[model samples]
Target: MHGGILGCASAAEAAGLWVMPFAGVHVWLTPTGHERAHDDCACVVHWSEALAFRRNRAVMTVPLALEQMAYCLGKEAFFVALESALHQHKISAEEISSLRALLPHGFDELFRLATVSAESGLESIMRYRLSLHGITVRGQISIPTVGRVDFVIDGWLIVEADGKGNHEGPEQRHRDHLRDAHAAALGYDTLRFDYALIMYDWPSVEAAILGRLRARAGRVVAG
Candidate 1:
């Protein structure tokens, strides 16, 4: 067996700091003769200098794990995990700054976009996607009688990205309806998207949001 530390998405997932779907294990072995003996199978191998700071013996340090994540998980998944780590206090802003030098060139902006306010991977993804369209989203906004919402767009639009686990059951459904009703009474438009809709049918979600924005824009102009 190869004596190596689990890195990248594998390490991130194990730390409970990653929620995105990934395939295969990623192991980081230093460039040593015994470490690089045979060709690998499904497990991804990274030949790099493993950092000394590690919480778990079997896994690499958070910074090193995140560096490997940037290389293997692409921008979106990496950003999601980074935010999750930040939210959980597993990683710090200083640690994230250290990673800027190690990541690919185009990924610098992702470090800037990373925020601890993102409650879940689904919220992180939705915010990132909307940012692509030049939409500025404010997250974790509190409103009287309705409590806190996920993302608020254009000051009047409440966009809730509900994950599979949190928003289930009849009681939760009833609460959600009451929140939406309260928001409506306060002249706010609520657009709620579930995991399936956000992940699979994004076009329809985008269309609905865009349509609402346009209508809101027209109302403002007319008044």
Candidate 2:
């Protein structure tokens, strides 16, 4: 039997690691020998053997938690957490290498996508999804008057991933409006997506981006 949190719950405790909203705590406990615990809506319990157990720590190590997270969060969410952890320096390269060795062969490409460039889970997910569509996204780009933008595509469109914590309230909204206005004046079109839109309604977001890109391409050809 193990005490304390493990897996996704442990990863969520780490700063900058974004996890999907879940109820109740995740704990590792002993089940009938070799049997894993059944997860319910309120709590998630793992009865499997821990990869590395530390007596002094209250939670699983960042690497172990991330390794366990793969099974619970699936590829997209797990990849987002991995990149966020890397960007926050919560996990090191050596630790990641060790973690990779323990994972199954199918996870190889997902692990390769981990990068420190994504400032948030939203950006990490967005960048990965866009890549799947063969879109080239340049992240964290700086335009002269616009300061630093989240991503730039086709050298004309700016994409911003807005998480709830950072982009909230009227004042912040006003600031964002000004930023978009300034960007537009410089001939850069801006598309700002909040957490819900990017996470849930992706088809619409993809259509908007692709439609804009296609329109821009048509205009350029006509010119």
Candidate 3:
């Protein structure tokens, strides 16, 4: 009973009074010369709908033998899209493995790093390399009258990567300074590199230590 100007256009096309939007489109027509758009498009029909209707009709009529492959697949429907998203975000290997372990059913072939323990000296070397240039470098250098120094490269460098429950309190600091002074007297340098430096800012820590080492080296070379 209700028909607007656009509705009349649709109705006229549907009722064979005029051509439908496409060759094979069968739009609904009422006997009273009215056309009814699909309920989904009742409120508004975009101009592009005509083009889409024609294209859809063309697609539906084509034989499997005649249709060519489509050029672009939707990203949401592609596995590579997911992989690209992961890589773009720099998802870590450990995180991927953890996710796979937690969600046992879904994903496959998670990334993982090789499992191996780093040696003590190797770890030290790694730190040393990270230190800035002109820092000291002393390997297995001792505290003279106390304990064996792990490393003392720069003249005042006293690097110690301590584990839990070691080197705590004023007494320890005093003793460390005393040892440091003794080493200084012996023309030694002291600078400490700790777990924090190793874990975070490792590069900057290495740069700093290297700087001190380079400066010490320069002094020795200059002398």
Candidate 4:
């Protein structure tokens, strides 16, 4: 009995986190409910007589919340939330392993794509979307003097995924350009894309990345 209408709103609002709502609220139950839920509130009534799960906690348990997410939103989005949780230190590796074992439906594929450094859901989106095209991208890897970046593809291309909030300041912008220069000097090509560009203009984004990959391949062939 947590999350959804239970308690996530104030905290998510306070932390400036975005939560995607389904048709209804989510809850684990052992055959109990106090009042009638609202018309819009959809609930997941998992019948579990397990005393621990039925505890009157404030928010839903992290494992249960993550389980609800995986069940409702599909594995791709679940990994996004999972990785973001890991990055925020909200959950630990050992706990995640235990949780994964508890999750029904095989999760080898989902965990296979997980990483601890996806700073935002959008970064997870970037990496997962690219992966569907057989592109392998690693996140938050640091170079010698160019500092750390969001995603790197083919071990030679550096991609920086920018949400609207982070890249606004002139100083940050200047530092990004300097890092790009330094990465280029180290023989890596860099591409920076904003949240809107990646989310809204996905076809264009796909085209741009595929083109860059093809060009790199061509260069290698010529060499």
Candidate 2 has a TM-score of 0.80
lDDT per residue for candidate 1 within 14-103, as digits (tens), equals: 888856778777887765524544565577777664443332333477777777777777888888888888888998777777778666
lDDT of 2 by residue, 150-174 (tens): 9999899999999877889999999
Model 3, position 41, has a per-residue lDDT of 50
| lDDT for each candidate structure | 0.80, 0.75, 0.38, 0.67
lDDT by residue for model 3 (1-223), tens: 2242232123223322211122222232223334445544533321212211334431111111001001111111112222322424423555445434433242232112111121232333343343323233444554657466755544456665543345578998788788777777776666655555555556675666556656766643211
Stretches of candidate 1 above 4 Å error? 33-41, 49-59, 218-223
Candidate 2 accuracy as lDDT: 0.75
lDDT of 4 by residue, 168-205 (tens): 88998999899999999999999999988877887887
**185: Cα error in model 3, Å:** 1.0
**Superposition TM-score, candidate 1 onto the true structure:** 0.86
Model 2 lowest lDDT segment of ten: 30-39
The lDDT of model 3 is: 0.38
TM, every model: 0.86, 0.80, 0.36, 0.75
Sort by lDDT, best first. 1, 2, 4, 3
